[model samples]
Target: MNHTDHLLIFEPEMAGHQPLYIRLLYHYLLENKPTLKVTFVVHPDINKRLVKEDGIKLQTVGNKINLVFLNETEISASLHNTLWIRAVNRWRLMKKYLKTTGANHGHFLYFDHIQFPLALRLPFLPEKKISGLLFQPPMLDFYGDEKNLKEVIRNYRKKWFYTLMLNNTALSFVYTLNPLFPSYARKHFTNGNKAYHLPDPSMFPTGDINLSDEDCALTKHVGENRKLFLLFGALTKRKGIFEVMEALKHLEPEYISQIAVVFAGKLEAGIRSTFLDKVDFYKQNNPNANLHVEDRFLSTNEIISLLQYCDIVLAPYHRYFVGSSGVLLWAVGAKKPVLTSNYGLLGYQVQKYHLGISIDTTKPKLIADAFRRYLNNPDDYERNTSGMERLHAESLPENFARIFFSKFL
Candidate 1:
């Protein structure tokens, strides 16, 4: 009967920010809307991680909350590895589950994955209300000054894709993490289905800063006198870790000795050995280099503790990563300075908010120069404190959940 009273949330991803994002919505629904029944369809990995990793007691949340794990066979690639194909397959699975569960409303917790198919105008079930959160939308203009032919063509294609997705009658709302997206959506793509900007939530650390044994070892390796520069969360070449390393070579021995670098997250699969080898070679060649690596999954508390323990947060992502960054928010929440990329939304926020140094991170020399500036006199950049509090306030989880859910639900 009253299908609108029930909400079905489908999230096939468990890595990165997926678990936290789903938990935020679940808790918000539980506490804010007591009568709303929820059914969470997630990857089997979520079952293993929900309670143990995130400390969420599903049984205690309420009787109205239900957990359903996705069938791997249903959403699996089955040989096709393309993103749109996988997105379409996931869409099919969600539609099937929506019908089976008899819920008229569904929400995609990680909507970016489904966007490819939606952009291509895939068949969405008629009359079913759907909402999704978008993290990396290509429609946003990331390259303003340095636009080549390929970049221009890509932006136009993605803008067209946004138009197609926004015009879908079944889609109720599209929420983006970038604050600039809503105005862009209004000016460019006019549709009854609203596209709104949602603040990327920041979970500030609480209680005592207790470092894990591995983290303690990292702290010991870096020592106490040197300024710690942290590159956190899913360490990969794309995150500009190697560029930061190469930038080290340009610094003098005294500068290197005064600063320490830590890569404190699981390295992307297959790149661990190569990264470690480079670290080893750099250490061997420059004994003054204080580089430490923790190539493993870090706990949430450990990550926050590391954030508090460090002097500066490093988010030197390449220009290709134009979306908002959780690391940037965490650094702001922790009131630490950052050396980030001057490319897209992330760069704009850093520059606008005086969060830290935003440079062209693709160049090692630029990164080194930023490091030098920070090393020279960190207090000189205390002017970066102006907008940190405002950004942190806007990024609270309650604000994120409220704005997103209030849109259509």
Candidate 2:
């Protein structure tokens, strides 16, 4: 096991989330195993908006890790073949390095959020030996609306190409993004090992933002009369915000008035106006439905403050919600109970840690019933949070690295 020669290959430009995991793992390697080489082939998307200390920044972390921000678009134009821009750059970048260093053998570790798409061109990359960390396989059906022949052909290509990569690739280790991923991936990678679960460490506080005043203010908004239900993260269609609204409406006006629904995160395109419009409608008739909506990206402290002050954390993701959730981990760390989808990893964690309710978010009746039941007896779920104490200990960065390395078998 020549750990020094290993390459950590990933595109740290998908969102604020992708780069965060890389930074966390970089620190882990920096402190414990300084010999390992870490290379970040970030896309320009990162350079534009997400440069906050919380986002991925190209600062000097360690001598071993190389931060290579190549012109990914350059490779796209260069390749006449139908290969995607990311894969083309990944191949070109590695080929350039291999040519320069004259190194024959090195392990490639792929831990990208979009793992399956990389398979579209992995065979073209130079590395002979490869491994991957799949928190969740890309749900192809949920990818887009156009299920035409072109999309179907692309889907078949992904499967065929991925099968080739898996047979040649040394190991394909699966992790629970949600409970569905392990089984979901195993159906494809029969030889792959289900890895020990690893939590996202960025969920831990940076200790930079003091949320004492913020938490006090938020709690004061809820007052002595209301239970706060919080939906945190970048608002998206898959997050089931509309379904949650439907469920809330199913409750009697009295129950609705007693609860405060706070949507705290950057709203997706076109969702802000609709969300606010619905919120206004709800507020006009049911003044008791104390709605506190923050239509912007949440800072780290804001996330912490939401978890600290809220009575319940809302997940309610769709079938597209495979693998683990960074948002859920924050709520768990705060020891706040959650009301999430019972389908996959959310259900597992909710059961494992006694976090809170996990019901089918798509079924309005079920969502409403869960909300009603939870509202009727909040302490029943609150009492279950004692299980999370062990999870906090288990998910430390050092512990994650130890477990990650132990998956070598």
Every model's TM-score: 0.90, 0.75
Best candidate (score: TM-score):
1
Per-residue alpha-carbon lDDT of candidate 1 for residues 1-409, written as tens digits (9 for 90 to 100): 1246667888776557767777787788777866667788877766466575556744424556778877668536411367677778777877887888877788887776666777667777786878888887765456334766876787787777777787777677878897777777777787723777888999775346655675455566667689999998878777998898889989988899898898988797667888898899999999888898988766666777677778999999987777889989889988998888888887788878888878889899999988888889886454356599888888998887777666544
Positional deviation of 183 in candidate 2, in angstroms?
Answer: 8.9
> Candidate 2: minimum summed lDDT over ten consecutive residues — where?
105-114
Q: Please report the TM-score between candidate 2 and the true structure.
A: 0.75
Task: Give the Cα lDDT of each candidate.
Answer: 0.77, 0.60
Colliding pairs, model 2:
177-323, 177-324, 178-323, 178-324, 178-345, 179-344, 179-345
Candidate 2 has an lDDT of: 0.60
Q: Residue 295 of candidate 1: its Cα lDDT?
A: 80
Q: Write out the backbone clash pairs for model 1.
A: none
